[model samples]
Target chain A: MNGLKNDGISEIIDGKRVIVKKPELLAPAGTLEKLKIAVRYGADAVYIGGQEYGLRSNAGNFTFEEMKEGVAFAKEYGAKVYVTTNIFAHNENIDGLEDYLRGVGEAGVTGIIVADPLIIETCRRVAPNVEVHLSTQQSLSNWRAVKYWKDEGLDRVVLARETTGEEMRLMKEKVDIEIETFIHGAMCIAYSGRCVLSNHMTARDSNRGGCCQSCRWDYNLVEMEDGAEVAITQEGDSPFAMSPKDLRLLQSIPGLIELGIDSLKIEGRMKSIHYVATVVGVYRKVIDAYCADPENFTIQDEWLEELEKCANRPAAPAFFAGTPGADEQLFGVHGKKASHDFTGLVVDYDKATQMVTLQQRNFFRPGDTVEFFGPNLDTFNQIIGTVVDEDGNELDAARHPLQIVRFKVERPVSKDDMMRKGL
Target chain B: MNKPELLVTPGSVNEIKKQIEAGADAFLIGEQRYGLRLAGEFNRQQVKEAVALAHEHGKKIYVAVNAIFHNEIANELDDYVAFVKGAGADAIVFGDPAVVMAVRETAPGFPLHWSPETIATNYYTANYWGKRGAVRAVLARELSMDAVIETKEQADVQIEVQVHGMTCMFQSKRPLLGHYFEYMGKSMEIQKRQGTQNMLLHDAERSNKYPIYEDANGTHIMSPNDMCIIDELQDLVEAGIDSFKIDGVLQTEEYRIETTKLYRKAIDLCVDQPDQYEEEKEGMLEAAEALQQEHRPLDSGFFFKETVY
Candidate 1:
């Protein structure tokens, strides 16, 4: 599951970047494989959730065994792993928390990201070795709150997405603790952890693991008039949409790095491996490129294009610049799908024979040209001329999920190198 | 335990006296721009007047400077907090930590309540703020009875719980209502839409309509049911909860007074005469039930476990 060691700042890969600074590029790891992919793709650290106690109870989170393995895998790359126990603990959900905290800590996670003080104190008491990074659910917008947590022994604080550039600057100016900011991924329209739309509408407590994402659903705006309901917004032409576009701060990489932002976070734990790889790879490049030459850096079109291929919905810069206007919102109900399909990931490569051992993620024909991208090399497109099964039998298509095949692509490959349907 | 003070959020300066007369021990008042989810926000003159009136009546008033501060709002934050403290507010209930610093910088010795809306679930978190000089903690509305009692038992800080009002389900910084209006060919003053007696939102899948409005803080969507736990006041009182809040925003003056009076009577009876309160629990529940609007459903919110999930 591992390949080349991650000794960053070693050399410029294809003249793109030689890592210079240590601003963390934090990615979401929904599974152990995703954690491997995230690190292999150049994420400095990854955040994951356990089966319970995380906000995404259904996120197929890591078991303690899996958590240990993921932590070990990340350690191989010299990256840290953070487990989320970031739920507001109700009385019923509060019983086994200390034991759960001890389990994750023993699993070798570098830190625990939590919002509530009870968990923070509990973890610090039960497992003093594990660091505490306050979750964004705390909505700490200014330096004073960061100071409060810092004084209370917090190792770091993830600023609320509503925090503006000025707020971040002031926070950096005032607080000595590490500050993490959300630079990309889906934006919650409401203040994080302050919403209970699911609890009210569906009786599922959002504070505990059951978020129905009711914010994305459509609604009808109405007004009461003398016992008769009057429709304010109509159907067909409209939906009472409150969905904020996914956040994309690709252009602000330099500003964030220059502003002394300690960590840049991408939000989505339940996303695909392809997404984790592409996004982590892009940010890794952008952050590296900017750090390599602070004054002469500019975002490349190819990086933007790579990001577009993995975007699950239309995106905006979000509150990075300021509170976005009407354009920031997704007025209609439908979410935009990714433009390209993730076809395969490189499991192993035989440089002597110029063949790649691939695991299929989507259906791909033998004749299809797929574009391959990796953190260690420049992206190149190769036409898939022939596919053979593990037993060396010819196959028409690489169809089944996780299907193993060998294809002669005549290209250099890394273990976690990913490919998508060509443009 | 002084039978726990009755804290009510008044919608106007005029309602503070009425609330005190109706048996409220304290009222939460603040400027709307600096407060989130307040029923009535007062200007400088009104805030000063309300504080004096509450002091005159030998009751306390907590000023809410709890808005999630943007840079622009934060410019006046220190002054606003100092103004509230200068006005002799009993304490300032704040959601932003900036307000805590403001209190420290400009209003030293002023007791503060950390009301980061939600996320103050367990006792350690409450005490965490208490260690930082916070005198009280506003418990999140999602806590269960067992958790609430545990928090009260463990924390040295004053614990405040909401016993009555409509719970706010969602809030956003974007002017979503104005955007919807402009999405259509219409325009309206979004902030003025609050308390219009008409505006509501109907989820496409759900049949009940929710109260929806906009303010400087942003759009707010409320629960379909108005949460009334008058019958459960005894449980909290016996658990030694320091304060019980009755949310008076979006509620009428009549409804606010009636609900406040009932909660007052219930807390007193729950403390002084538990048996008589037990005998009168049904009639009190009915009175609170009668005060609710016909369109708004009334239930004990998150008080019972079976439905909390």
Candidate 2:
């Protein structure tokens, strides 16, 4: 094991010992159910937001009670929960912040992620017991920022998404605090939430979690000439010049582990439970496999295939490899469709009748062939033999969102196993 | 009531004294190294001379070091901060927390102003900065009058809101303009003619056009309408705001001089005739209407309606 110390557990694989350094796999959770799914799928930690002050304001954000339940549920799986209060505070935003901070602290959350300096100071004072992780919104791209935050006594600093793996290694060499970076998710065209295009176009505040995604709008490159306007036409459909491809850094896991990054973050708080489970499960497998043996580490094509099946735009290795250019820019399109549609989620399973109660997400019919997968189970395809509502009335299709519906299957599925319509 | 101070951005070093003579109470300027606006950056010598000129007229000057900094140049920043502090700058306007922390460490008692690129929409954030040693918080340009008033009422820190000027709606750290030029195969040395500082960029799907400019801090796309709230000086005064900013670094000298003088007149009238300020407000509004550029649009941005969405 080159540079791999024995701090990791040794396991016998093919009658040989392998040492593994397992970093925490942190995932994003938009709701309490997603939080449960993420934890069950082997996420060591999950970052979420409360009703107020989270950047994903429109998300089914947790209330104080929900946050308490989430913390307790995650604690059962030995995972941590971090809450976001990362909005840049204006003058009036401070009045009830202390109370919220105190409540979150008392709720036994692992940490609080904040962007504003004053917010960090307030958090330290009001919720001294809770750890404070610097939000990526701070756009901390330098070692000095990391050192400055560490010297100020912050527990961890989530490095900006734009940091290269080389810079990360250098930063880790300089600072002794926990380092977290976005390993996967939708990348912001603007510098990590430092955008106001949404605010000026619509009344939605992007910093306050109301991103209108103005960057993804179809745009034209135009120039002014002689008091007249002319279009800079290209050989394509309308150019989405500002839209960056979603980031997926599955290939760089060994390098990131060698640098000893404290946590690897996945960024999808506003996604469905199926998306969370699929993404977190994939990352967990890859990291664990890599940790078991570094010298023989190999990038698996199956992991990428599984990720492509979830709700995502086309994925590209972002700035981690280098400063992304036209290759990383999405052109002529706003978003790409996933390979499969998330149909439903397993809520309850009656082994005797082979009936599974599910919360329908997308439209699916009685004869649709769907695949079911969870934390401990391999994906298995099952034909939906019958579909009925809560009152046992037969339905042609499960059309509504979050509607309670039951379907007959051949085998029992665990709670939280995601169901997706096969292509 | 005290007259609200007028802060102006001069187009050039020579324009500084003239803007002060036109009744500019203070100056918010920047150097070429770390300032937000690339076109308005003053050399170090000009910065020192400008400070002397402002102080000669009994005015305050704040230097803007508000660019989002990267780690490669982190050491250079400490020297830059020390240089600005030693060069007699009254205060430094910073947006990055790391830079603010550096300043706090370098000059523990220096007057530091927090200018987050994102709007500080509420009072709690300002109070948070106030307790952390920030003397002033410039309210975000998108704030409605009600939010500004609430910020001033609730946050104990000094509040500064842009009352008149172009508002930067989008800022990015990527070298988008350079990249565009490269993509277009255009020469990098294209000489930009005067009066062409504002570049208009539009989307194919949307008819609205935005003004884009780039510098050391990266690209800044501005709102279409120039914010003109000189007519609402009394409302701002009543909201406990005393500092009004006018961004004219990209505007013509004539426009800068006229706008500064118009706000100066409006502030004096509001202080002198509080009960009948409406009469003075009409006169100032007429002055502003007369000073408008022929084809340029202007609006009272988020001033009347609540902008919290």
Candidate 3:
């Protein structure tokens, strides 16, 4: 049995029975640093956007040169990279269509993620050899739409997030194409990628990647003649009209794998490296464990606990369970942030003095109990004692950013353990 | 003398008959509070019934199927398309391509007209749909009169220009503050009930404010200015426009009768006194202005080659 063996279906790659990895740990990389962190923490692949065309305009996206570097870096680490160019192009902007496709093709990226039919047709004409993955913005609901794209030479379809596993399974049965879905991320109030509300209301087109998110604002009902204010539904207070809660499917990996999903996409291109690493690491461990023993394996409470640390808004399975009502407001109150601060992880530990050297992010004084979150462990709290700077001077707190400080510990610690304060 | 087509929006059969008697050439039945009060009022069966009644009075009936459809409703729309086809609608107006194709496939013989929401801006788009079974295309509100003439020359489809009505300021599919306001407690119906004279301020920072009402009684303040094109009849005829569309589907019967009668007389005068048509322009403008004072502000639309100042 090879390292890949985990499920019923095993393949012999180079004379070894390899267990096929069901779903890949796809992470979001907004920057090169997050890209590196995602790979180091056991991500199978990463999805990113270039400077201009992706859906997430706010994410600190990479330039052409940076994308090339990022792609090379992911490749070196034996991981794949997907680039987004999913914007609706106007007639004036169609002139540069060929150049952009050819540029990305020459860059040697894995595939071009697209939304518009015009772009798809243009890409087919310009770079026929490049793999084209249909974006979720197309609102691919039925098998007819899926079959239409598949017949048009699309390699994969990012199934609309509004679909359930049963629907996905049905779609997979109908077509012989790869299916990708958002396993985790922020949900849109409008139909997947089809919202013109922002543009209509605020002149900022969400499809064009310039959404002002006027839907998330608070509103009060007023009477016409007197302009008498009637009801006020503040953010997070109104059940019928709140932002959709975030989607979390960590526990449902087995069912998703059974449904034959080609990729498990994580949704957050604008997240921190710690978030990327933590999410990737948790899913990686979960999938590995499931593949090892699908029948006997059970999800630990710790994995769910680790997922909560990465910022969530009352996690729900989303449309996979059933259609979410108007009341499942995903956007929370304005001031809510995770109570804990993630400083940094322990890169290397010294063996001689039984002391652990820390790569610090924020200041921590003795007696401050911080949680140690690692790839396998859920999260375990430990109290700080006998802290010293790298120069061997005793310090009350390590205040400097990225400052390496040493502290004595009673228990053994590994490189994977992440230290966070004020949990 | 030939009378211009009087298009009246009547909610009930009685209202429809009254408008017909009052000189309405066509009856547009839609569900606005006091108008056609039923939801989905212009479905397949209702359209057949409405058309039968309009044909009794030697008038035409056009149905409005211009709402945007999400994915789940596409199949339900297929049934509606089939219904419209069997009912023999004079023209099925639509905005979505999927709906257009469905209507064409279901009823290839039926006339399909492009709704204003489709944003038919140039000759290419107009011709594109014309080739694909669209019998007529409604001009976008932003187009100038000369542009419409140029488009008409290139188009294979019949051109229908809005003569008068409340013009939609935003594009058809864009999100509306109304959705936000409705989700909140504010009633859009209240402003509609109070009439346009009663000022309703939405917010201090809001650039535009339309009246809203409590329940369904408030007056809808988004009404566009009435269009009076009696003076421009000669220019429009010379421009080769096949149809002049009146925008009100839910206005008063008296307003509909008066405007339609005025334009009808003007259309006839253009044929008899071709040279004298230019001299009658002032009288047409005066009539249109008179109607505007009693209703709302009016614009010349894209009938003139340039923006009418």
Candidate 4:
């Protein structure tokens, strides 16, 4: 059992009977509903933030009041909540820093996530007891940077996304500190989070949490002859180009665990509940399976199939396995299409009657092929054969959006089962 | 009349000696194509050696340490500062405040000059650093002569203006192309091909066409207009600026000697006949035109605030 004793559960490791505390299955939640879904699906921790200061402003982030409710709700489920206030503050904006810090602290949040040194200093001075997780935005690529933050009283350093397992191991060996790495997510074209390109191009600093992703814009090539201008559009596109692949590191879980990385992070803060539930569930299963038998553990193909159903660019191992090249680059074309269109999920599945009822989001018709994604199950896809409406009459399709509907599922489904169409 | 400072960007040691023999006041050692290049093998110690050589010939030398430093190199700041200070160089030109503070703490007595990238738009920020410990502030290339005078009043330190060479239209805070190479898993050697081979897109086009290999993001041309303030020496001196800076970090010894001699002669005329300075303007323009012919279509730049965009 490789699990920590404080948490529940036991598993065998290294041919010895050891208690394996379930590793915290942290998930990204972009909305209130997604937060609830993540909690219900067994997320040990959820990281989120208010719209203004957090790194991903484009995501459906919570407001201050909503964040307060999020914290309270997570506490009820016995899970931790971390709020981001990680924008780089200039001298002028430092005035509001105290209020923001006080607000989050008073709200009973777990910790404050920050990147800038001045903000770190301010947080330490004002809310000394509040835990501070150093954001990856500071680009902690080297051990010296980590040591500096650790000396400054930082609780944990979210290592730069570009760091490899070997690098993480070396860092862990060098310092006695809590290290976190992004196990899954969108990889930045810039070094981890040191990008000022968007800010320079459009006054939307990624460091300040307002990133107008100018890197994603298209550009046309221009040729010159003898200093005389020659417009060349051989590629028939803007000379500006961008890579649009999402990072996936599912196979490297054992490697990460061996590296002694404290936490694994998932990148999307603007994805649906089904996407969150399916991904988290798949990872949770893989982690459990690995702990059961590290040497013989294998990632099931069905989990990879479920992952492919989610909306993503092409999946690549990123800089972890080795440095990526042009072959990995996603040019003008968008990658894979999402197989299932997300409707509301099954909040509760009745076991005895083989009936799975869903809190309908978008309208689902009888002929539409739907897939049920739940924890510990390979996402089962089936065409909607018989739909029982509110009137108990079998209908070809259920048209009303967000309406509750019942359908028969072949497998035994549990509570918090996510349902989607098109799979 | 004081001999005008001869700013030369020598590619080799022989060129440095040649410029010294041609009555140059100072040797400004920088990479030829790029505005300033002191990375890897070419570092502060090498710059110190160049400075030492210039000092041997009774010439002052200014080292350009103006590149943006990533956080990874923060620890190296103190060592580099100590080396420059210990070498007894005239001044260390810097852009980042982290570098500035590191230098101030490491070598408290050394003179630190603000690189133009500091964006000293007004006296507030200028005086902020000047009060801290800077000896000189390089005014932004885009500033009008009038704005320079305005800033001159509030500045506690000596003001240096770019009297010649390329003018950057955008701030140096733009993301470096070198970073683009890192992201794509390519070598920064790609920069030498694109950067040196052609004038950057933003720069004025010359007849020398070369292939512009786009970085992961895109390609940008160099600054089009080379600044010429030779005819305005009297107005500049009257405006109370202490030093005139030339931007070429890459120029032939002949170019440096001729330009320096002409400017030195103009400055003498201005001192000899301050009231009749207009009489010498034609001769100065002729000399400036001769240099401009070698590098055509010189821009007066933001000195008089002509339409740029």
Candidate 5:
């Protein structure tokens, strides 16, 4: 296998052999490191945010320098980078946005995803070289909205999470444009940009990037009676939490491919590197497997297991099949812990010394069994026999966060490989 | 012409006549099935009456044909647009391109106002939508006063800003309140596709209670504070905003009428004698403050920098 991942599937179109190559696997990258991991693990494209003008204000967004570096890294695997400028702009927020957008274009970003028309117009005026895609925050549920954006020169529109399966099919039939949908990760209980619970309660504008996720917080039902506020419903039976389970669409890969969707996106920008690699890798493998052989290929059990291992929150299918009801609404606060603990990230492998160097992400003790896996290599189980620091002193456990640790390994593991232990 | 046109949301055709008498220059009305988040969903016959009443009074009536159409809704919209236009509606306010197409195809010369709740943030988008056929743009409530003024100054189309109303912070097609009730194993009657007065959501950790209701368009989670921007009317009038909207979604018909009259007095005072705005605003504020529920305090949303963040 090539070190750089092959992004598209092979297929025939218009009676000729045109690899039925789309439903592009788009991943989210919070930092430059995550961008590299996404490209290597098998993303056709990665959407990221710059330092400003994004909904994820708290995410470790890239600066222009990091964005340029990230773009160059993604280019090695023939992957594309699109920066997110998806904030609902306030008056002050508009200051210096044109220049920021121009800088994104200069960094060779393939496109910019925005929800505001102001950003679209500015990009078209000053950064004409960059493509523009509409963010899902616009809550585009119908074909006309899709067609509307297309009329205004947008390349694609990320369909709202509330977009029903029937609506998606109708949109594809009615509009001739690239359609993207969120297939996995956290789902907003409110339609993406249609929400500002964080803004109202915390005074942090969810639209302008400071979303505190107030919907996930508990609420008590009340009503006004006799011109006085009355508490009609108490929070006891089940908490009045508005958070939904994280989205998982492993079962719907073939349907999306058949639908001719241009891109299948995962929604997480503030997630871990372990999450970026694990989720991207699973989706990539499943998409490839289904594309390679449509009829015989079934969702292997291992893929679901792999998905379950990395879920920092409980995952489910939302509003994809039909209008979800009580089953879809999560009325509790607890996010599911990762089934497996990510122990380390492989930094370098020395064949001469037969040792693998890594930066510790989680604690690992001697005799702890770990599995080493990479984008291009088959996963192999390894026992933590002896761990040594960079100064060559033996250690009982790799405890400090991101501390460099080395151990003897006969198999040749490449850089960016991950090591994990089942919790 | 110096003062912005005062637009009011009337609960019915009868209220349209009453509100016009109370000093509204225009009316926003529609059938419950067509308009997404309206206070009153007038039926077809009522819609016809509304158009006639507004026309008879020399006032404007704009129908809300702004649902995000699925194929079924899209297929039905062309006939609906024609019906409203045939009834002599002044303009059609819509957010979706489907409705845009309907208005374009059915009523070629019908005035269009692109009023997507959150997307119309900047002048560029407003100008772009103007090119697509919106004669006027209803700016998002999220915009600050500076942004609003900039949009009014720079955009090709006329601009309308909500001067007084409730702001919907969240909307979803899923019957969130119904499901939230079901999840709690507590059954409560939630009126669908219409306004309900009894339901409110209180943050368990905090002390804000947001009024929430479900409709055909979806569940709308309104902001806890009543967005009362009557105090900002002078700035809007001075900025030359084409229209001022008073959304009466959850308020009483009397509150709607009273508020409309207060804004009428306020706008007239500002447009007539600009120097008296501060003096006149006190009486306006006294009346506006009286209407406020103690629990649901009034704040001028997003106009000031503190709330804009």
Candidate 6:
């Protein structure tokens, strides 16, 4: 409760008292600020992308300096950092591969997740100190593969999202290496990393991280009569047939923990700091709550509600219980618009003056009521009592984008706490 | 350099003879129980007959058990692998690691073809499997020419490339079509066209129409245009590609025979007249274009251009 660190759960293993091995809560960090927020909020580790070789090319990926700083910050907060080198490397990409690996290794990363064997081989050769975790793009769903990877010196394997809880338990019994599974995020319509739709359609290589998300695109059912497009199935609407609802496994945390899952991963490297704070914070609390009292614990509705505050499509437990049916898919729809607007992000908090400093992301009026919440802190309402600019001059409203603004608060707010007008 | 062998997938016993007559050097046959292609699957007797016929014609026959297996149904695989080997199959073409392990256990000496659907995109992966006892690596469809050339040069084991056919752009074990139909309040018992149920759909924004089909292996969303690399035969051969595969299970028997014949001519010209590749390229293009007719559209697909961002 004092900071990011939490006590591990105790249990009897092999007839002796031992730590029950609390699963690592993994979160995504698109930027350096997000990285800090993830660690502060509850993430035991954060996965991020470097300047090159990593997927999510469009995300605010870390430069070498940023990665070094991110690593140091995570280390200080007792969180591990894993870099993404999950791209399918081409011959043209061979030259820079070694340098990228070495740089990330030197930046204090715990591991690098990769899909290509060539990258794994190179990581073993050039940066042997850095552990290699197989990416889900490999679509490894069986025990033999996990066993093979464990024998092949891979430190961990991120199970494909298609793996069910029962399958996970079987895999756990078969392999000795760590198993990480995605607990939240967008789902791919195609098999994990084998998708060619994005590449053939948009020319962006999904393997190289230029996923245009062609799967989310609205598609009309067309009858090809002699290679000619015939009738459109739907009228005046983009029927998003391939789009899947964002994955939410909050309800399955206790089961995942009971099954001895090593890491519960949150998939969003291109999302915002607000997203990192909100999602990571909620998961952190849930994991901590479960670890405190596993037998008597149950998932709170507020945890799911807190996650919904972040802009995402309708959430579902995809391929978790079993192979999802029609009810699991988000057919004929884009995305469900977020109920709450992301207003601003707290940059600094001063306890002496009882003033919270923040950068405005959306417009907020001085008289509007706002809710303040962050990692490890309870949600509290605060009226915008005295709005001031960077110079501390009183202002009527904070309208400029990323404008530094401060306001007096009743309770002490911490950095990375989000400010929103609506509940 | 060895002349690249023309391997074709014959859907039925009838097409087996026709494909061989059309000059296919090898055949990829599937079984009704475990093969990825449900329609093209042969029964036990038919599989043995096809293997004997292939052997009698001095051609190789590889059996496909390439469907991704779930743990629920995985216990049935060992018996299947043993049956495939006992049936005198030349090799087992597969994608799943569990199946590979089963093949290793049941048919230790049986030649293994690492079906590229497992995403063997680089030479390291190809060689990794080769070291683990795989005889061939069927290269992934997503690789560019440069990557293919690099893999062929560096790979220690044999490598095969799918030269022509419908490329499966997406594959999942989930029943996407059933879900889609139920969601749309439509009946799943729609009539098949000419006894073949080919489902076609497209992105509303793009003009491309993707062909979709489902079987026991789940749904396969094929590329809008069928891949035609007849003109690229010489290039693929020169890149040290050992075997050339022509996908025919989704196609008609006549289409299979015609395409096999077409690729046979192209492969011979490339092998016999190595220096005349450019000169013969135009004629090959014309012949390949003629084979397209009015139904199948063709493209180089991920071979010529780097798949975009």
- Docking tier of model 2: it is acceptable
* Model 4: per-residue Cα lDDT over A1-423, one tens digit each: 122122223445566543253356677878877787777766777888765567786778787788888888898989878877776553334567778777777777788778655566667678777789988765565565566567556888887665656556656766677777777767676543434444334435455566666445544434344646554334443232445467788888777665666677787778878778877777777777876666677778977876777756778776565445555556556466777678767756777888877778777787677777765566677777788866677866677777777888888777777777764
Whose DockQ is higher: candidate 1's or candidate 2's? 1
- lDDT of residue A400 for candidate 2: 98
TM per prediction: 0.92, 0.87, 0.68, 0.68, 0.93, 0.93
Runs off by more than 4 Å, candidate 4 = A1-14, A17-25, A192-194, A200-203, A223-225, A230-240, A348-356, A376-378, A386-396, A399-401, A410-415, B1-45, B53-309
What's the TM-score of chain B for every model shown? 0.94, 0.91, 0.74, 0.77, 0.95, 0.93
**TM-score (2 decimals) of chain A in model 4:** 0.87
Model 6, span B1-309: residue lDDT tens: 679889988888788888888999998887645777543878888889998899999999898887666675566778888888888889888777777678767878778888856266777778877877788999878787778888899889898988888787787766766666667766443333223345577654666778776666666788777788778776678777899988875677787888888888888878888767658777876776777735457888778976656
- Lowest summed-lDDT stretch of 10 residues in model 4 chain B? B202-211
Candidate 3, residues B1-309, lDDT tens digits: the string is 333344545555555666666556765553322121122244345667777778887887766554433344544656666765666556666554555656655766577777633134556556656765678887765455666777777778887776765444322121223333444445564243332233322332443333222222111223234445666666557767766656553345466656666665566567677767677768876876776533245656434423210
Q: For residues B3-84, what per-residue lDDT tens digits would candidate 5 score against the true structure?
A: 7899999998889888988999999988657786787878889988888888888999898987665667777888998888
Cα shift from native, residue A77, model 5 (Å): 1.3
Candidate that would win on lDDT: 1
- Model 4: what is its DockQ? 0.10
> How far off is model 6, as Cα RMSD?
3.9
In the range A309-399, model 1's lDDT, one tens digit per residue, is 9887888887877778877788765577787899998999998998999999999998898888887868898889889999999999988
Superposed Cα deviation of residue B2, candidate 2 (Å): 3.1
Could you tell which candidate, 2 or 6, scores higher by lDDT? 6
For residues B1-309, what per-residue lDDT tens digits would candidate 2 score against the true structure?
666779888867798878887899888888746767633667777888888888888888888887777766565777778877887888888776667667767877778787874656667767766766779988888777887887788777898888887777777665555555545555342334222454666743545677776665666777766788877777788777968988874577888898888888778778887756677777777777777654346778767644453
TM-score for chain A as predicted in candidate 1: 0.93
Ten-residue segment with the worst summed lDDT in candidate 3 chain B?
B212-221
Residue B279 displacement in candidate 6 (angstroms): 5.8
Q: i-RMS values of the candidates, in order?
A: 2.2, 2.9, 7.9, 8.7, 2.1, 2.4
